[model samples]
Target: MGSTLVQRRLSSALAIMTFAVLLTGCGTWWHGDHQSVTIFTTPPDAAVVVDERVHLLAPGTVSLNRKGNHHAVATKDGYESAVMTLSRTWSWWLLGDVFGCLIVFSPFCIMHDIDEGGYYTFDDTIYITLDRKSAAWAPVK
Candidate 1:
C-alpha cells in the first residue's frame, strides 16, 4: 500500500507540472498586446508613418497591438504619398487552441494571433510612384 501511494503521488505531481508547462507555452514568452510587423517600400528609404503617429523608415520593423486596424503611409520625395491598412484578421492557428483549454491561464493558443517574437511581416510591399501635379497656364489676374 505504501508503494502504491508513492506511485500515485508521483503521477499527480507529473500531471501538475505538465499543466504548468502548457500554461507557460513551454517556454514561449510574449506580451499580450504587442505584436511585430515589417514594412517595406519598393524604392526603400521612404518615410513610413504608422497609425498617423509613429514614424518609421521603410524596410523597417515595428511593433503594434493586435486589437484593431493599423494603418501605414509611405511617402518619398516627389512621390505621391501612399496609404495602406494592416488589419488583424483571424488567425487559423487559433483553431488548434482547443487543446490549450486544458491549461489554466493559457488561452494563448486560442488567442487571435500567433506572436512568434512579434515578427509578423506585412503581406505586401508598398510601392509609391512619383507625382508631378500638372499646372494649367492661367491668365494674369
Candidate 2:
C-alpha cells in the first residue's frame, strides 16, 4: 500500500510537470506575430505614414509586426504634422513563457516566444493631436 501511494504521487507530479513543459512559450502560440493598431487624429481625417512606407488615412487600423517599434507621421493641409512612435513592450502573456521555461530548466524554451515576436505588444489604439499652423503660413484648404 505504501508503494502504491508513492507511485500515484509520482505519477501526478510527472503529469503536472509534463503539462507545464508543454505549455512553454504559450505566448508565441497565443499572441502570434502581428497585431492590429488603430490610429485616430484630433481632426478626424488625415493622412498617416508608417515607417515612411505604408500610407494610411487616419481614423484607420493597420496590422503591424510585433518584432519592433514603429514610427508614424500624420499630416493635414493646414495642421502641423504629428509624429508618433509606436513602441513595443513586454507582454503579460510572456509570463507563461518565463514560468514554463524555468520549470523545465531550459532557457531555450522562452526563445520560441522571443524569436516569434510574441513576447511584445503594442497599444491597441493611439491618439494624435495636430496643431494648426499660423494663419499666415497655413495652407489654404
Candidate 3:
C-alpha cells in the first residue's frame, strides 16, 4: 500500500506539470514580442531609419517590437529615399496559443498573449531600392 501511494502521488505531480506547461501561452512562451528583422538596400551603405527613431545601415539586422506597424526609410546621397512599412499580422503562433491553451481550458493564457503582443509578427527581411536623382538635379560637388 505504501508503494502504491507513492506511485499515485508521482502520477499526480506529472499531470500537474503537464497542465501548467499547456497553460503557458504558446505564442508568448515561444516567440515573445520582439523579432529580428534583416534589411537590405540597393545602395550597400544607405542609412536606414526605423520608425524615425532607431537607425541602421543596410545590410543589417534590427530588433523591432511586434505590437504595431513600423516603417523604414532608406536614403543615400543623390538618391531618392525609399520607404517601407512593416505591418504586424496574426501568425501561426497565435493558432498555437489557441489550441494549446484550449487543451488546458485556460482562456487567460490566450488573453495573456494578446495583451503581450505575442500573437502578431513582422516579416523577417526588408529590401529597398533607391533611385538616383536626375543628372540635371544632382547635387553640386
Candidate 4:
C-alpha cells in the first residue's frame, strides 16, 4: 500500500538524522604527536625541574609536548622544595589555578603602596633576616 511505503521512508529519514546528530555531537578526537605539561610555583622565583632534570628558567610555567612520565620539582632558598606529578587532566587544572591566581593578584600588586616613610611603634617587634640564594635543581648524580 502507499501508506506502508510512506511510513518506511519516514523511518529512514529519522534514522539518518539521528545518526548525523550523534556524529556531530561527538566533537573532534584528540590526535596529536605530543603531550602537554604545566608547572607552577608559589614564589614565582623558584627553580623548575622536568623529569628530574633542572630547567634553568625562573619559577614559572613551562610546557612540554613529549610523552611519557614527567616529574616536576620547585625549589628556592629558605623555602621548602615542592614536588608535583603531571598528567593531561591534572596539568589543565594546574594551569587554570596558576592563571587564575595571577589574574586575581595582578591588581593588588599594581596598587600596592611601596613607600617606607611611615613608621609604626609597637610594644614588641620581632624581625628575622635570612640569607638565601636563588633556586636551583639538578638530576640525581
Candidate 5:
C-alpha cells in the first residue's frame, strides 16, 4: 500500500507539471532572443518613422525583429530630422526553446512559437535629440 501511494503521488505531480508546460507558450515558457523597444526623444511628439513605413510618435514603443535594420527617422516642424540606427545582438535565451521543444510535450510548445504575438526579444532603447534646422539660406543658382 505504501509503494502504491507513492506512485500515485508521483504520477499526479508529473501530470500537473505536464499540463502547465502544455499551457505555456514557447516564448513564455522559453525566453526569446528579441524584444519590443521603446523610443523617446528630447523634443517629444516628433514624427518617428521606421524603415520608411512604420510611423509613430516619440515616446512610443515598437516591436522589432531580432534580425533587421533598426534605422529610424525623427522629424519635427522646426527641427532637423534625426536619423538613427539601433543595435541588435543575439540572445543566449534563444537556446531555451531548444530544450523546451525537446520534451515530449513539444507539440503544444511549438504552437506558441508559431504565433507572432509570443515572439519579440529585442533589447535596445532609442532616444533622439533633434537639432533645429538652420534658418539661414542661400539663393539657388
Candidate 6:
C-alpha cells in the first residue's frame, strides 16, 4: 500500500513536469511567430522623420511589431532630409545590414563625425521643425 501511494505521487509529479515543459515550449513557438520593424539612420545622431514629419531627432533605432507601410526620414537640423521607405520586409533587411555594419565597424565609425565646418557647413544650432503628418505613425487597417 505504501509503495503504491509513492508511485502514484511520483507519476503525478512527472505529469505536472511534462505539462509545464509543453507549455513553455508552446510559448516559445508562439513568440517566434511575432514580427518586428527596425529603423536605422545614416548618421547615428540624425533626426528620424516618419512620413514627412520629424518623429525623433538623430541616430537611433526603433522597433515596431505591428504591420504597415512607414516612411522614415532622417535629418540633422542643418542638413537635408534623408528619406527612406520601410515595409515589414524592407525594414528588417535594411536594419539588419545597418546593425551588422555598425557592430563590425564600430570603432572606426565612431572616430568619424559629420563635418560641421566645411562648405556644407550649416548652422549646427538650427532645429528643423518637421510637419505633423511626416512624424505620425498611421496604422493601415
Top TM-score model: 2
Question: Over the stretch 1-141, how does candidate 3's per-residue lDDT look in tens digits?
Answer: 999999999999788768666646777778878899999999789999999898988999999887788999999999999989888889787776666665567788778888887888887988889999887876879
After the best TM-score superposition of candidate 3, give how far the Cα of residue 141 lies from its true spot, in angstroms.
21
lDDT of 3 at 5: 100
Model 3's alpha-carbon lDDT is 0.84
Quantify all predictions' global Cα lDDT against the true fold. 0.60, 0.88, 0.84, 0.42, 0.69, 0.41
> Candidate 5: where are CA atoms >4 Å away?
1-29, 32-34, 94-121, 137-141
lDDT of 5 by residue, 32-89 (tens): 5346789999799999998788899888988775545478899999999999987655
User: Where is model 1 more than 4 Å wrong at Cα?
Assistant: 1-17, 24-31, 91-96, 102-141
- Which one wins by TM-score: 5 or 6? 5
Q: How much does candidate 1 score in TM-score?
A: 0.56
TM-scores of all predicted structures: 0.56, 0.87, 0.77, 0.37, 0.55, 0.33
- CA displacement after TM-score superposition, residue 134 of candidate 6 (Å): 24
The C-alpha stretches of model 6 lying farther than 4 A from their native spots are 1-29, 32-38, 51-54, 90-141
lDDT of 1 by residue, 1-141 (tens): 999999999999889767554544321234345556778786678898899888988788877775566888888876677877786654433333444445454666444335542212234334443354456699998
Q: Local error of candidate 5 at 108, Å?
A: 19
Of the two candidates 2 and 6, the one with more favorable lDDT, higher being better, is 2
| lDDT by residue for model 6 (1-141), tens | 999999999999788655443332232133222333334444456667666653764433344322344567666655556556554332122232234334353332212111111111111122223322344587999
Ranking, TM-score, top scorer first:
2, 3, 1, 5, 4, 6
* lDDT measured at residue 39 in model 2 versus the true structure, 0 to 100: 95
Better of 2 and 6 by TM-score: 2
Tens digits of per-residue lDDT, candidate 4, 10-69, equal 999788655443332121112122332334455556676667664844433454442333
